[model samples]
Target: MNIKSVNKLHYLIALIAVFTSIEANAQEEIITVKKDSIIPKKEESKKSEEDRNVMLNAANNTGPREVNIGLPASVGGIMIQENGMPVVHAFWPELPTRTWRQSVSLAKPGLTKLSEVAITQGELGFAVSSETKLGSDTPSYVGNISSSSFGWIKGDVNASGKIAKNLYYTAGIYANYDPQSINFKFTNWADRTQIYRAGLTKKFENGKGKISILYKYSKSASITSHALFRYKLDGKVEEIDGFKIGRDNYMLPNGRFKYLDIKSGEYKWMDAGGRDNESFAHTVDIIGDYKLKNDWNLNYLVRGRYSESVSFNIFPTGMTQATPESGFTVKETGEVYTGSANSMILSYTPRTPLKTFMARAEIKKKTDKHQWRFGLTESLYSVDNFTNNRSFYYQAAEADPRQLVRQGAATGNTDADGFYNYNVGGEHHNGFDNKLAVFGSDTWEISDKFSLSYGLNLRWEKLKGDHYLTPRTPGFTLADGERTKFDHDWFHIGGSISGVYKITPSFGALADFQYTENNGLLTSYSGNVTPNLPKTRSPLMGLGLYYNHPNVSVVTQFSYLTRNNYLTRLNLVNPTNSSQNQVETVYYDIETTGITADIIAKPFKGFQLHYLITYQTPVYKNYNFNAFGNSYTYNNNSVEGISKVLMEIDPSYTYKDFKFWASFRYFSKQYANLTNVLFFAPRWETFGGVNYKINDHFDIGATVVNFLNQRGVRGSISGAELITDPAPYNDRLMVGTFIRPFTVEASINFRF
Candidate 1:
């Protein structure tokens, strides 16, 4: 049936239930009294029979048994119950074995209930997911490159439940495994890694207290095979003294390597060889919580972690390289070296507003015409530094002076124990109203057809950080000739005001204004400079219309924002004179306006649709300067202007013990920059899946993502000038060398 018919039917059912309940209540209240003075034993029996008949009729009229269809076992929306309460709806047998339930029970006065527990109730479930990449990869310029194919598998098993009415517990074990191998022409290498985690939690006192413990471990090992070719030259002709050319010499020049043959040549150049590295990490955590009363709570948490890694590169002292095709001898290299390092991280979060230390007090009261609630809170946060160490390797010949005789000479032996260390320390504080302030509201009953609501929010915050860096050897210094110690402090106060007026039950208008003032110290010891933004301020305003209904809502909003310009500098010392220095400064300012529209709808059962369109124009003004006295500035430049539209549709259907769903998303072309010279094309994506229950204890499913075979690139660049190169986006392109539509998943669940 159509949506209208379905809605009408639901209304009719609700009305029937209401009328039936009223009639049942009236029948239950019926009381029969007899004139006992003249009543005999037969009269009393007749009265008793009438009472029994009335009770029977009342029972029949009370109501029908509510057949609650449990929520979907997986991949489905939750249902909202009457009075806006959320109720879980699941398919029987397919529901997740582990579930969490929270509730508060009333108890006798003075004796407060204090049970707090997080419980996971479910049967045993194991799931595995994996992904693999295939190709002969190329090296990356930024860091060490691994040209190989790799894949990993992850799985977990979990169970939780309440042991008693007030105590709860949950435990789970997770594991991950990855085996990767790489092939560089004839050389090949492989590595196997594994990690595991286990955790448990216990809760007590109606739910007033909780205790939890967790542990994790990880390890990996790698093996490799390597080879090298050598070549020899004799005047204009290259040849091996005791070798005969073989079929392997397919691409060799006729006279370049005609003398050397593979059959009689000494196997001087064997496989280059491989190495093995092993590493592991372990972690432990403990946490506890306590509730003092209905409005107060406390908690504590601590964690510790340890990690180590070691590696050894194995190789022969002397190995000769040969030509790619012709087996001509070239040069011999020396033995290889290996190294390793161990690192650690320690951190703690104390009791504060965001943690355990902070507390809030709230007072709530109601009057015939208005209601009010006020609350106050204070909080603190802190974080420690992160540290790491690394070891290096060196070859004997790498330090040899003979290498200087060749066109190029190898640098001195690498540091056998080189490492870099750095740390970051910071803390923050926050104080603000716990709730939005409300002054007045318009109501249809008190006013015309218009209704409105106005509210305010206020917040204050502070942040400070001190960062340090120390390099190996000579130790580094900032370009400004200053020691490597940087510190800064920032503070801000911001708030927003919002109001809404209803034109009709389903339609409304809204307006909101936000403003913030930020002040911070800009210090660069290296630059020996500081700047201030005492007048820095940001403001935003929005106006919109909202249409809301039982199954759908549409919103159209226009917003504008403006921000101040801020500048900072970086110091660099001159090479010729330590006292002479050069500095660089960057300045920024921005303003933007946007119009957006969004729609949410559920026109069919088990389905939802979403659509959004946004148009925006953004302008930026910037200035840059270098020590060479070169400076450039762009004033009120429209850096980017774009219009975008997005549409998403998801539909689901359920049959006897089976569920199916499909979704599609589409995007319109987006323009960048006021010049409108650059743009991105529209893209589309589609996904579909099906799941079926084999029995009460098991089910299986499969899903395919990106079924449309659509591919594109996205990225941005910023510097002295605008960058238009597409390389940033190219890295994200899908080569489509693999299957167009790729994915297959299956699972089985067991409950006892």
Candidate 2:
């Protein structure tokens, strides 16, 4: 044999000998303890503690997951743990991305491998998990910011164990960047999300009771802007620069609205960054439970959370000019002057900071055939959004001998001391809100063939806002009696009923009725004559069938959903030409019908697949709104963000020590305007990964996201008042500003 081959054999032989000796010593210790003991204690042996945290192997693949998915807001149910335990939550914690677990954890921790004696059989338990990952993405739409490719690194470490008799504790730190982040900018995006969690639970051996305490802190800062694109309009390219959403679209006397362009010195509106947004929330949970009477149990839970969202706007260097189509007006003659572009302005807009506090409590019981629950919730919110849309207006040298803006300085830039007297009018809003709700629910398993569940909730809410216009240089100002305010309160009720029937162990059918209520952001900061906005509601009727087998599971549901009360605000010009303009709220209704199907198949060993698809039509049953002195109708139009067809497929395979999986997501084309003319194309994405274990101690993996490098918006919206937005901005896509492009990620796993 060669020298290298001989050395490898020797190494293997030495490892085997060492392990054999350890095993022999372990066996000898156990025998010696038994022979020397007079009375054995009820506690587990010290050996189990020494071996408690075993390195994960081929036995468990789902990883250590204590959190639940598809929480109370979505589809509801119990989540099964890898260790066969149950953790019941009173409600989905009010968190960002709170609807579900973000997705499959990339660092699947070894914590899932705790043995029965270490956790279930003994009173004491312990587990630890930590992981780090780096990811990359290539985005296609680079309108004015960032690059085509970027990368990010994320990490988390968590540990949980029994600290004392009947007491167990858990803590973890989660690090992330950007909202909806599977990946973020290589560097420039400057938005991030960080979260920390700590929890503890104690059980009383004498009374069949338990108590739990949990605390969470989360912070996020996201840059809210879109990567722009183009649309075809009558054989011409109409590259949209801005969305007409919530912010001020100032109109000049000649009926023209102007936005600045930094690169081309063009006069057009654009969705650019002015607000640096930040948000933070802290939560605390305390729960206590006890058994009472025969087949009866009592439980109480209370959760409190405080959160805030901040918006700050700053000026960027740019220039706004007057064009021939939208001419400047002569101050004395009230006549239009169409000429070359010539103007520049420097300005900034700031948003009122929003703060809120919420509390929730619930009492419940679970018996063999019946479940009962009661809950109450209270919330308070306040914000003072003050804005000023003014600038140091200047006259540019390029104008055609006639100044477009007549009143500005004869210079193209701000003065050396940054002092200028010109200022435009601004808007203000001061809002306050209080909300309360009471809810109860019951579920009964009447017989082996059927089960029923029902719930109801009553809610009351109050919103008050004071809105007014600030001073202007030459137009209507607060000093000219241009002030307004509003305030109002409202009440609502919503509930759900569901039932199921079983024909066999593997087959079942179900029906459900749900009534849902929602609202537009409450904008009642400080106001007089506030008209209480009506609540929005959606009542649903659904039916579904399910089949379960050792190798496959399938569920399909169809539903008809009715919608009511969409809130909208419009500006009204006084017929008397008064200084104060009126703002009014308008409402609309819609109807939708849809079908959802989900399937999970493990047709053979080492292979599995999950597929979900939805087909929905959200047509406007009725609608009317006025914008910029024009009225429009949208009856029978499909709702924004509701794609006709949406689908996702995830498939995975395992062979010996290797595993591979891929996820496919699809979205259909849709409109971005009420007229149904502005359209965005369809798109699909592919993401996949592969993992191979080198041995019991180490494994390596790689992931490819947007494998096809596809790009496009996933959801779209026409426009609306975004009270939560830092600045009044509109004309935007929902998520995925051109879906991320193809990029690869590599990682390694070390277990001990």
Residue-pair clashes per prediction, in order, are 36, 22
lDDT tens readout by residue for model 1, 1-752: 12222122211111111100010000011111111111110001112110100111110111111110110011111111110011111111011111111101100101000000000000011011011110112211110111111232334444444445444444444333322212222222233344444455566657677666655455543332221111211101112232211101111111011111111221111121221134454545455556655444454434444444322222111111112221111113322222111111111111111111222233434344333333333323332221111111111111110110111112212121211111111111122111111121111123444322222223343334343322222112222122233333334444444445667766767665555544432121112233333545656566777777768767777766665544433222222222222334454655666666655566776555555455555555553444434444445554432223445455566677787766565545433222233444555556676777778655666555455644231111111122233333232211000111222333344432
Listed in order, each prediction's TM-score against the native is 0.45, 0.60
RMSD of 2: 18.3
Q: Cα miss at 503, model 2 (Å)?
A: 4.1
For candidate 2, lDDT tens digit of each residue in 1-752?
11111111211111111000010000000000000101111111222211111121110111121110100001111121111111111111111222112211212222211111111211011122212111112111100011122344445445555677777766656555422222222223334556676677788888588777777676654333222333333211122334221111211211212322212223333122212344466766666668776645665545555555432222211123344444344443545554322232333222234455555555567778777766666667666453333333322222112223332323332232222333332234566667777777677878987877666777777767666533333332334444466556676666666666787876777676656565544332212224334566656566777777778767777766565664433323222221123344455666767676766688899888867677766676567766346565778877544457767687888899998888776656655434455445566666687889898756778767667755444233212211122121223212112344455656565443
Clashes of 2: 22
For candidate 2, give the lDDT of residue 371. Answer: 74
Q: TM-score of model 1 relative to the true fold?
A: 0.45
> Residue 446, candidate 1: how far off, in angstroms?
10
